[model samples]
Structure formats: C-alpha cells, structure tokens
Target: MTPIRPLPSYLVQRFHGWRATTYQENRAWYRRLAESGQHPRAMVISCCDSRVHVTSIFGADEGEFFIHRNIANLVPPYNPDGGYHGTSAAVEYAVTSLGVAHIVVLGHSSCGGVKGCHDMCRGLAPELDEKTSFVGRWMDILRPGFQKVAHLPDGEILRALEMQAVLTSLENLLTFPFVRTAVEADRLTLHGLWSDTGEGLLETYDPARGLFHPV
Candidate 1:
C-alpha cells in the first residue's frame, strides 16, 4: 500500500479546536456513566460498516449496549487455540464479565466481507487463498454459507448468505460455555437481525415464524 501523509499541521490545529468543544460535552456524559460502570442490557455483534450505526438504529446511548464489530461481523465457533480471537474475546467479556442479558447478531445487506467470501468461493479472487492472508482464514467461517447458496440467484444468494451468517454466529455463541450456561438457564437470549441498507429497515428473527420480520 502506498503511504498516506498525515493531516497538514493546520488540519491538526483545527481538529484540536473542534475536539475541545465536543470533549467537554463527552466528559459530562462519561462522568455520569463512570458512577455505576456499564450495565448494558444487550450485546450487539455488528459489521464494521460506517453506514450501519447499530446504536443509532436501536435508539441507544452509551452504557446501554455492549458492541463488538469486525469484518462481516463474524463469530467463529469457540476454539481454544484460535490465533486471533478479537471477536470471541469481546463475547467472553460481554457475556461472562458484563453479564449482558441479550445478544444480537446484526447482519446487513451488501456486506463487503460477505462479498469477498463469495468472490473467494467462486475462484474470483484466488489471491486470497487459504494459505495467504489472515482475512482468508478469518473469512472461512462463511464457507459453508457460500457453498450452500452459491448456485442460487444473486439476490437470493445475498439474502440467504446474510441470514445464514447470523444463524452461524448464533451457533458459535452457544459454543462458549458461559453463553451456553446462561442460555440454558434462561439468563440470555440470542437474536439475529438483518438490516436492509437500501430500505433502511431492521428485520429481526422470529422463531415462531422462522423468518426475519421487520422491527
């Protein structure tokens, strides 16, 4: 990758000026939040997409939701020796350490990571082969989904892949001993959400209906 220059000295000066005003308001909120520490009601697993702001969609503020984000918002099945377990670590802290009651796996339309996985599966991006980069290994969790829906129409495949990823993550969540215990004891609930970027709608899993219903 080509190196990019840092902000011009003047931009840094302007940033400090703007940050001072915002930081003051942030400080007031933090002071109150620090009093009781975080007692979030839910832990959200979402994609690292700038367009999909989970808090804004859910009408939540700080301390209300524990959020974990990553490429394609993946949750690998619990592996004791998983090399880089950033997402799983967050789950451990959120479910065990923080004792969050609900966990939502938020998948979205037109996910870049999902698209990349599809490309890899179709042999469109052989450069990202299993032996090469971390992303290749990281995205392997979606391999089953891709294989299952690869032959379908593009639109159906995309939707199916999104939902499949959410279901897969939910299965992964249960692999964690703490999460499994809490769930079995009725202490935790797992939900899968599909956010439509084009329609700007939130669809939640409906166990009774076995479908994603609008929220």
Candidate 2:
C-alpha cells in the first residue's frame, strides 16, 4: 500500500488551535486522565449526526462518557453469528469492560438516518432497499420501529420514527445477555432520549407512561 497522506490542513490547524487553548489550559487534567485511563459512568449511543453534540449537550469533559455513534443510534437484537457487529462490539466494550452504569440511546429530530428508514419503509428509497447497500442492511434494524409509524401522516411519521429508534435501541439492548444480566443485578440502567436539534430541546422516554417527556 502507498504511504498514508497527512491530515487535511484545516483539521491539522484546528487540532493545533485546540491544543494551544483547551489542552494547554487543562494540561494537568489531561495528563491525569491519560495516566488513569477512562472510568466513565455512562455509555452514550448516539446517531452519526454532526449536529448532535453529546459532550456539549451534557457539558461533559474529556473521558467522562464512553460514546458510540452509528446510523440512527440503533442497537440490533442480539445475534452471535460471527458477523461483524460494530455497534454491538461498542456496547459490549462499554458495558463489560468499562463497567458503565448507564447506557443512553440518544436520537435526534430531523435525522437523516431516521428519515431514510421512513423513506425505505414506504418504498420511497429504492437505493436503500438494495441487498448490497450497507446502509440498507444496517437500517433493517429499524424496520420494526418503522412499522409503528407507518400509518402516520407524512408530517408526523418522521418524528415518530425518530422516537421509535431510541425506544427500539433500548429494547434491543436488553437482548444482549450481559446487558440483561447487569440490568437485572441493578448494575446498569438504560435510557432513551430524543433531542430537537434546532430548539436545543431534549425529551426522555418515560417507561411508565410509554411516552416521551421534556427533560
């Protein structure tokens, strides 16, 4: 293979700027974190949306959260077929190795992934229906979620589907044996959240009410 190229100038400049500011100001904290390794309390499984900033949302510092991002923040039902499961691997690492006490499924409004699922379910996205489409196969995890909102109006289906993704992930998470065992032993808790990107609003799922409430 050819030698790897250097990072883009803009990204390199940004790194330097951050190092000169944030890193310099918190040099001791950074060193301590590096030495001690991460002992994070929570694992946040969020979407691959750039607008959803997990750190800024919770005012979290470095090493505070073990984050795993994927399309629509989905967690597939447990299956040990020796297949490559990136999201499942992250969850296992976060729960089993990191010993995170909480697992948060963070879904956001106007998410392209969720919209894609809505479109695919309704036959509007034939490209995503192809067997060779990685995104299509990955998004099949949300097919059960889309079923709940399939009958809704066009104006409501997308948002409903977004919320469903969070709930679906929360449900699928328990399908993992370790996750279920930890939760049963009172060592782990699962949470579902939906954020309105434009309004900077967050709503959490209330299991008792089976609904989302403003947080």
Candidate 3:
C-alpha cells in the first residue's frame, strides 16, 4: 500500500510544542489515565461543529467524558439488522461496557446540519434530496423533529429545530434496550442540552415542562 503524506509542518510543530509543554506539565495525570484506562461517568453525543467545544464548555478534563460527535448529534433508533452502525456501537459500548451513568444529547445554535435539514425539507435544497447524499440520509433522522416545528414562524423555526434535535436524540436513545434498561433500573440518566453560540448560553430540556430552560 502507498504511504500517506505526513501532516502539515505547522500542525506537527504545534503538536510537538504541546507534547513538550502540556504533556510534560500533566505527565503524571496522563500516565495515571493511561495505566488505569478511561472510566468516564458520562457520554456526550454532540454535533460535529467546530464552534461547539464540549470540553471547554463543561471545563472537562481528559477521561472525564466519553464523547460521540455526528453531523447533527442525531441518534438513530435501534435497528439490529447486522449492519454497520457507528453511533449505535458507541452507545452500546458506553452503556454495556463502560456503564456510563449519564447520556447527554447536546445540540447547538446555528447548526449547518440543522439548517440543511430545514432547507431540504422545505424543498429549497434539491442537492440534499438525492439518495446518494450521506448528509441528507443522516439528517433524515431529524425529519420527525422538523415536522413538529414546521408550523412555527420562519424566524423561530431554527432555534426550535435545534432544541428538537436534542429532544429527538434523547427519544431515540431509549430505543436501545441497554439504554432503556439502564434508565429504568436507575443506572443511567438521559439529558438534553442546547447551546447558543452567539449568546454563550446553555439551555437544558425539562421533560416535565416539555421545554428548554436557560442553564
């Protein structure tokens, strides 16, 4: 097989600098983690958005959170059909293997994936309507969510859809028997969260109120 090219010099140099400084400064902690292995208490399912920094927002340290990122942080309902399912595999491992106590579905404001789904559903983005589009298929998980908010005013639709993404993920997570069992047995808890990139605010979903409240 042909060998792949190395990373850019600047990135390599930056990594070396981090290894010499941050790694050196936290050598003992890193060593401990390496020896003990990770046993993170929570699993965070978040969007693959550069602006949404899970660690920075929660001030989480290494090995503190088991994170899974996807286009829209959407969780597909459990389907045991012997197919390739990355998200389901991660959730299974987190629940059965790691025994994570919490599973948090985190969405954020100004999500390109959410916007794309909105556009595609509105017939505004014909490109995403193609069967060959991976993003479109992934965003299909959030279509039910879109239907719920489609009646809202155009201006208020985006934010509502963002929160819906979180809620939808939380709802889908329960489709996994492991997740449902853990939740019912009080071994695990499910949470939904949304972040406002512009306002630098976090909001949490309240199942009782069926609404998101500022955190």
Expressed as tens digits, the lDDT of each residue in 1-215 for candidate 2 is 87899899999999999999999999999999999999999999999999999999999999999999999999999999999999999999999999999999999998999888888888999999999998888889999989888898878989999999999999999999999999999999999999999999999999999999999
Residue 166 lDDT in model 2?
A: 96
Cα lDDT tens digits, model 3, 1-215, are 76888899999999999999999999999999999999999999999999999999999999999999999899999999998899999999999999999999999999999999999999999989999999998999999999999999999999899999999899999999999999999999999999998899999999899899998
User: Candidate 1, which ten residues in sequence have the lowest lDDT sum?
Assistant: 18-27
Deviation from native of the Cα of residue 202 in model 2, angstroms: 0.2
Q: Which stretches of candidate 1 lie over 4 Å from their true place?
A: 1-28
* Model 2 poorest 10 in a row by lDDT: 113-122
Give the alpha carbon lDDT tens digit for every residue of 40-109 in model 1: 9999999998988998898887899999999888899888894778888999999888999999999999
80: Cα error in model 1, Å: 0.6
TM per prediction: 0.87, 0.97, 0.97
Which structure is stronger by TM-score: 1 or 3? 3
lDDT of 3 at 114: 98
TM-score-wise, the better of 1 and 2 is 2
